[model samples]
Target: MALIITDECINCDVCEPECPNGAISQGDEIYVIEPDLCTECVGHFETSQCVEVCPVDCIITDPDNTETEEQLRAKYERITSDNG
Candidate 1:
């Protein structure tokens, strides 16, 4: 599954830079995670970097995306491609 940022986010900015996919961003009052871009750090890291770095534990799985490992890899490829 992709990662999500809950309302509990303190806007502490801990999780933003840790996201290799650039899926995390600053929102109006807190941080947000882009489901389409979030890969749970599949190809880049062993686990969800945002979730680990979030100070308030506000980053959680985005149940709606529910991506498989292959799909996450595809997303990772796409993200890196765009980043280049």
Candidate 2:
């Protein structure tokens, strides 16, 4: 699944740089994760980099945008291909 930043986010500006997909962005109130761009770091890392760096643990899996590992990999490929 993709990740979502909760209201609990402290806006410390940590998670944004950690996201390889550039999915995290500053919102009106908190950091927001774009589900379509989030691959949970499947192809880039063993775990989610945002979750690793977030001090408040405000990032959580987005149940509403759930996807399997294979699907996540596909997304990663698509994104990287666009960049290439």
Candidate 3:
């Protein structure tokens, strides 16, 4: 599943740089994770870097954008290939 930054985000600016997929960005109010670009760091790390660094713990799995581990891996591959 992709991750979503909830309204609880404090916008401390820590999560943005930690996202390997560049999925986290400063939204009008809080940091937002783009579902298309979010793989939950499947190929890049054992855990989601943004979530690890977020102080407020506002980031959570996006139930609305759920995907299996295999799907996330595929997405990671696709994203890396596109950027490579």
Candidate 4:
């Protein structure tokens, strides 16, 4: 599943750069995760990089965008290929 930044976010700006898929960005209020680009760090790390660096623990799995590990991997591959 993609991760979503909750209103509890402090906007500390730590999670944006940590996202390997460039999915996290500054929203009107807090940071937002683009579900299309998020891979939950599947191709880049053992765990979610954003979740790792978040100070307030405001990041959580987006139930609305639920995806399996295999699906995340496929999305990662697709994103990398588009960039490469």
Candidate 5:
């Protein structure tokens, strides 16, 4: 599943640079995650980096876009593929 930032987000800017997938971005106020690019750090870390760095625990799994480990890996590969 991808991650989503809730309204509890403090906009501390802590989770921005931690995302390996480049999914997190500044929105109107709080941060937002691009579900298409997010792979929950599947190919890069043991867990979600945004969650690790989030101060308000706003980043959580996006239930609406549930995905398996294999699917996450595929998404990661597609995003990082050099050959495209």
Candidate 6:
């Protein structure tokens, strides 16, 4: 599943640079995760870097954008290929 930054986010600016897929960005109020680009770091790391670095634990899996591990892997490949 893609990750979501909830309203609880502190806007600490730590999560943005940790996203391997460049999915996290500054929103009007807090950070936002682009579902299409979020792979949970499947292709790049053992864990989601943003989640690892988030001091406030504001990032969470999006139930509204649920996806399987395989789907996330595929999405990661697609994103990398397009960018490559």
lDDT of each: 0.85, 0.96, 0.95, 0.93, 0.91, 0.94
Which lDDT value does model 2 have at 63?
A: 84
Q: Name the better of 3 and 5 by lDDT.
A: 3
Query: Between the candidate structures 2 and 6, which one is better when assessed by lDDT?
Result: 2
Off by over 4 Å in 3: none
Q: lDDT tens digits, residues 33-53, model 4?
A: 999999999998999988998
Per-residue accuracy of model 3 over 1-84 as CA lDDT, tens digit each: 999999999989999988899998999999899999999999999999998998989999999998999999999999999999
Instruction: Write down the RMSD of all candidates, one decimal each.
Output: 1.2, 0.5, 0.5, 0.5, 1.4, 0.5
Superposed model 2: Cα runs more than 4 Å off? none
| Better model by lDDT: candidate 4 vs candidate 6 | 6
Clashing pairs in 2: none
lDDT score, candidate 5, position 11: 91
How would you encode candidate 5's per-residue C-alpha lDDT over 1-84 as one tens digit per residue?
988999999999999899887899999988999999999999999999999988778899999989999999999999999436
Whole-model alpha-carbon lDDT for candidate 3 = 0.95
What digit string (tens of lDDT, one per residue) describes model 1 on residues 1-84?
Answer: 888888998888788889887788898888888888889999898888887877788777787879889999998998888888
- TM-score of each predicted structure versus truth: 0.90, 0.98, 0.98, 0.98, 0.94, 0.98
Off-target runs (Cα >4 Å) in candidate 5 are: 82-84
Better of 5 and 6 by lDDT: 6
The weakest ten consecutive residues by lDDT in model 2 span 57-66
lDDT computed for candidate 6: 0.94
Give candidate 5's root-mean-square deviation (CA, Å).
1.4
RMSD (CA, Å), candidate 3 to true, equals 0.5
The segments of candidate 6 whose C-alpha lies over 4 angstroms from its true place after superposition are none
Q: Lowest summed lDDT over 10 consecutive residues: which window, candidate 1? A: 52-61
Model 4: CA > 4 A from native: none
TM-score of candidate 2 to 2 decimals: 0.98
